[model samples]
Target: MHAGTSNFLKAFPIKFAILIATFISLLLVGCSDEAPGAKVPAFKAPDSKAAAKSGAPGGKGPGGPGGRGNKTFAVEGYIAEFHKPSGSFQTMATLEALNRVELSAAANGRLVNLYAKDGASVQKGSLLAKIDDSELKAQLKQAESSLHLAQQKMERTKGLVEKNAATTTDMEAAEASLKSAEASVELIKAQIAKTEVRAPFSGKLGFVNVSVGAWVTTGTSIATLSEVTKLKAKFALPQRYATTLKVGNPITLIDEERAIQKVGKVTALDATISESSRTRQIMVTVDNSKGELIAGGYAKVSVELQSGRTQTIPVPAEALTLDKDGAYIFVVQDGKASMRRVETGLRTPIAVDVISGLNEGDTVITSGLISIRQGSSVRIREIRNNTDYEVD
Candidate 1:
């Protein structure tokens, strides 16, 4: 019985150990099934470190992307050669008029006749319009009759006074009567002449403001006449150029496109600068027999400053950019854009002169500049079969 009891105790201890092992294995299998997959989340590692640093009381890192630097900016520019003046700047052509006048009536009267129309050629002393003069002619006739009678009496009194047949006072009265009648006739004739309006100078007439039977007052404009056969353009120049400009100086007037249409000579220059504008007036005359030029047209004037020859670098105006440091451009080097600051001189609508900060044979990025910043990588596309570097 002691042996059997010892055997039962040994079997019991073995069974208890086996049950504890099986329970632990099942618990581990259940826990493993409940846990998540092995794939790690993106950026979680770095984010965890960032959160820890931020939560720290005295962290060194800035809050939420504030430590990032300036954003990259893209821009475009073009390559151009710098130019220095060779002889002188080209002359600019401008339109101007020398003399302008408005024709008006001298006396108040109804317009009886109009002989001239707009754009009509007229000569000096040519009759333009006529006012009613019937009353003036009747007064002239009466004065003439009185003068005839007065002269006859004066002749008789002179002979009588010489022959001692008339008193001295009577002779004097005859003389005064004759003079008064003659003066009255002349005054009436003068009024009659005023009725006929004549041209003061030979020129083409402008529009006539008054029509026949229209009552016009003194100093009312009748028409405008101008001599456009020869035109004069007057412009103001800075006082500094006053000394250089003189009468008879040859000037080439340039149209807006820098085309030289006419050559003119300086006719006059004001002696002093105007106090308000600090500019002196200059007058230039050009032959316009063809009537191609009209009055009051704008022109550009180019004057030769110095007689020295220098290389000039001309670039298109669109290739220029401006920043806080004046003007600049972008130059592409080894697939990277380099910011280059430039100095600009004369500027035209199409082109500008570069004074400094660029060299010949350098390629400049004229397009795609708005997408590039300094030291940015770029992909250059070749302009297929396009020789001209024109900006759209």
Candidate 2:
């Protein structure tokens, strides 16, 4: 019985060991299948530290993704030119006639003769208009008769006084009577001369305002006569230009309507400036041999300033810039723009004369200057076309 019980216990122990081995193999298979389905956290890409070091936003380098490098700008410029005058010209003051008069008779009389007409050429002392002098001549004849009688009586008294037969007071009374009669005759003859109106100077008579037999008063204008062989042009200039405009300064006169050009010289200038306009009056004499220029016509005068051997640079007018520092321009070098302050001289619509602050051969940006600041990059698109400047 003891041997049988011992065999049962050994079999039981072998069975338990086999059951434990089967359970361990099933557990190992389940673990291997679950390990294939399990997901580890996704591997993230490393941040672009190199891009951050480059100062690009969002860790991106230059021109990478959203970054932008230096930008290009368009601009324009021109080559400088120089100008030299052939000859200098001066400015002049205008002129006027020394005397102007209208001839009319004082008394109302018949117009005996009309010697002058419109545009009639006359000489000084020539008879122009004559009135009837018959009444004046008759008065002069009567005075002459009385003077002759007085002179005979005075002669007799003087002879009597010399012969010691007449008193000295009687000779004095006869002399006084003769003098009075002679004065009356002379006054009548002078009245006759006043009836004949004569030309005061050599000139061309204007339109005849009076006709023959036309009654005229003392102040009535008979005709207007002016000497138009030469014209006097007067102009007012600033007081500062007084020294520049002196006697004998040559000037160019232009008639805008007729397109006629004339040359003249300054004849005189007012010594003092006018208190009202603060300008000095200058006069010039222009020869109008052809009588083309009229006295009341308007004219343009140009005075050439004498700038001796001055260094000047011509630039485009568009390149000029104004600021608190006066005027300036932009200069381009090595694809960058720089500002240069300049003093400007004569300026036209298209070009300007640079007096200072820029040297010859320096490149100036004509366009895109207003949009660009100092040290900004720029790309020149094309050069501007060459243009001419007009001087007056």
Candidate 3:
């Protein structure tokens, strides 16, 4: 082949390739120009003053370049005010029978008889059930026979001793034998009495756990007896009110489970306050002769205490925050949130008693607490009453 011809062929291919790339580039430029609004302008640096004013980098917003200004938070505010005294305090209480006991077998034997039916009312000392007492009775008879023999021997020995036919030791031995026989008789009689389950006091009986002819041992529970004529509601009160409550103060008992309400009177107060709970134990008595109250139930006990001061500064419970330092609240001071440490007292479901560190007209921030910082600029977007604030 000729060298010139080959070189010409290679140059022709390169020229063709260049032409194809140029055509493609021109096609792309034409497409871009035809597209609507596809043009981008040249970049330019933003003005410092405009950037700062718009809260961009190096602006007045919090955590910005300068870090000099705090972010303004929009929050709901509450107005503190005086609240009326509640005049009473409520606590959960448990109801108990004035006299309640679990009847159990005192001696081990077969339960032979159940004289009183379940839920039956009985008089004091009434026979409620009986265990098999045949063996005990037999033992008692044997002891009685022994007692009779000892008595006869003692009489003979006394007569002989009186005639100086028996020594003093013989008479003493006879007396000892008689006393031993008497003790045995009494012991057997006591055992027999234990076999008979009698009502300790007049009360209604619970369901018998054991049936007739069931073998029962000592301390085996047979049934429960409760004198429901009167009930005692037991509850605890705060230690602060220990001295204010008396034995005769009237209280209201509400059994929410049964929807029963009753008036009761305080009957007893514990001698000491419970250190663990910081409360004083108390008991209130209520009549249940109509069988309205149930033993072993729960009740809401409301104790009427002396009315507190009419003017009490109360704030929404959610407005208060706690930390290692103690409870503190955020109040708007000079358009900024200011943390004020506070001492709290009696609390209600919706409000807290601010004993100090807060004022009646203070505006407390109740919402947007998570975004709030000490001395952060705050804007009150909504106003709420003391008890109308939202939690969290």
Candidate whose TM-score is highest: 3
Give model 1's TM-score versus the native structure. Answer: 0.53
lDDT of 2: 0.76
Index of the highest-lDDT prediction: 3
| lDDT, model 1 | 0.71
* TM-score, candidate number 3: 0.61
- Clash count per candidate: 24, 7, 0
For each candidate in turn, the TM-score is 0.53, 0.54, 0.61
For each candidate in the order shown, give its overall lDDT on alpha carbons.
0.71, 0.76, 0.85
Better of 1 and 2 by lDDT: 2
Candidate 2: where are CA atoms >4 Å away?
1-99, 304-392
lDDT score at residue 236, model 3, on the 0-100 scale: 89
Kindly list the per-residue Cα lDDT of model 1 for residues 262-362, writing each as its tens digit.
Answer: 77788888878999976687888888777767766766665554543334456666667887779987777776777778886555567656668778756
